[model samples]
Target: MTSFQQLLTDLGNKSLSVLDRNIPKSAYVPLDLSVTNAALKEVDVSSASKLGEYINRHIAMNEGKVAYGGYLEKRGIYNRSDYFNQQNPETERNIHLGLDLWIAAETPIYAPLEGEVHSFQNNTNFGDYGPTIILKHIINTVEFYTLYGHLSLASIENLQIGDVFRKGEQIATLGDASINGDYAPHLHFQIIKDIQQYSGDYPGVASQKDVVFYQENCPDPNLLLRL
Candidate 1:
């Protein structure tokens, strides 16, 4: 195994699930290209609305509340011109850098660990993370940051930098397609080791050329989610 993977294994049992403990493990559905039990193959996931409908149906059929996306999965759902390349499909940013929790609008999001709000902003691009928040945490003297994207505008209304949040504290709420960069309701949770110069926002998707760098910079969020 790579050093990063070993690190995550070493830190096992020290992390927390971003979701509520009351939610059973059976309620979390693994959504990747390998999922063949759903009608995903027939749906036009390129369209955000259609993707939303597909996710809703999957959740209902599985009797689950959330649909989880794995790290590094090449999600074809981001084929929108506003988000990906319109002319050259080869340059499309399809590799997801974080874990996606697909759920209904207005669902509460909690901090998986103790941290302070680092920065926040409303990225109004066509297919961007409308309202985003980043938190800085120091665990065992190792500093890191966690990002929460595609949130309701009201979630950042009164938020300020340096605001401290306890583990499991409600931080934000999921947003709808209208204000969440015109996509389905969900939470984009990411872990970053070196944010570089970014403040409120960071790239949640990377190209093939830079996938290796991101894979190391942004380790598997399941390390913390454990779900």
Candidate 2:
């Protein structure tokens, strides 16, 4: 593992949640939206409502409140959106590079670690992150970032750069399909070792050709989430 990843791994065996703390870890169940999942063969998730239904059913069947997991997962959900459709296997950006927490709209999202707002904005595009926040965190002299995407519009209305947020503080609430890129309400959490020049936005998906670079730059959020 890289030093940055090691730093993240060393944060805590079980880190804090971006979700509510009252909700125990047990309530955070794993979800598989990868293309390899045979279950999604006939089911369509490109539609926000259809995906929401699938997620709701998954959460209910698993007896969980939040369905999480998707780091490095190859999904077909992006295919339906012209914004993400490239029709090229090698260059198509369908591989999710972040961990997603599937939950209801307006659900509160917290900071997993102490950090300041690096930037926040409303990314308007089909199948894009609506209101997003990027937090800059420095630990043991190593600087990194955490991204919170698909947030409610109100989340960034009054936000400013460098705003401080203590770990576990309420940073933003989840957004609904009408605003959050036409998808089920969920928090797209990602750990970035090097954010480069990105401010309020960063690539959350990777093409096969660029997966290697992204895999290193963006480690599995589970390293910090541990959910």
lDDT of each structure?
Answer: 0.82, 0.91
Candidate 2 structure quality by residue, lDDT tens digits, 101-190: 999999999999999999989999889999999999988888989999999999999999989999989999999999999998999999
Candidate 2: residue 10 Cα off by (Å): 1.0
Please give the RMSD of candidate 1 to the true structure.
2.4
Worst 10 residues of 1 by lDDT: 31-40
Model 1 stretches with alpha carbons more than 4 Å out: 1-15, 33-41, 86-90
Give the candidate number with the greatest lDDT: 2
Query: Candidate 2, which segments miss by more than 4 Å at Cα?
Result: none
Q: What is the Å distance of residue 203 in model 2 from its true position?
A: 0.2
* Per-residue lDDT of model 1, residues 27-139, tens digit only: 99876633343567787765778888887887888899889975888766666545654445456677889999998889889988889999999988787899999999886
Best TM-score among the predictions, by candidate number = 2
The per-prediction CA RMSD against the true structure, in angstroms, equals 2.4, 1.0
Residue 174 in model 2: lDDT? 95
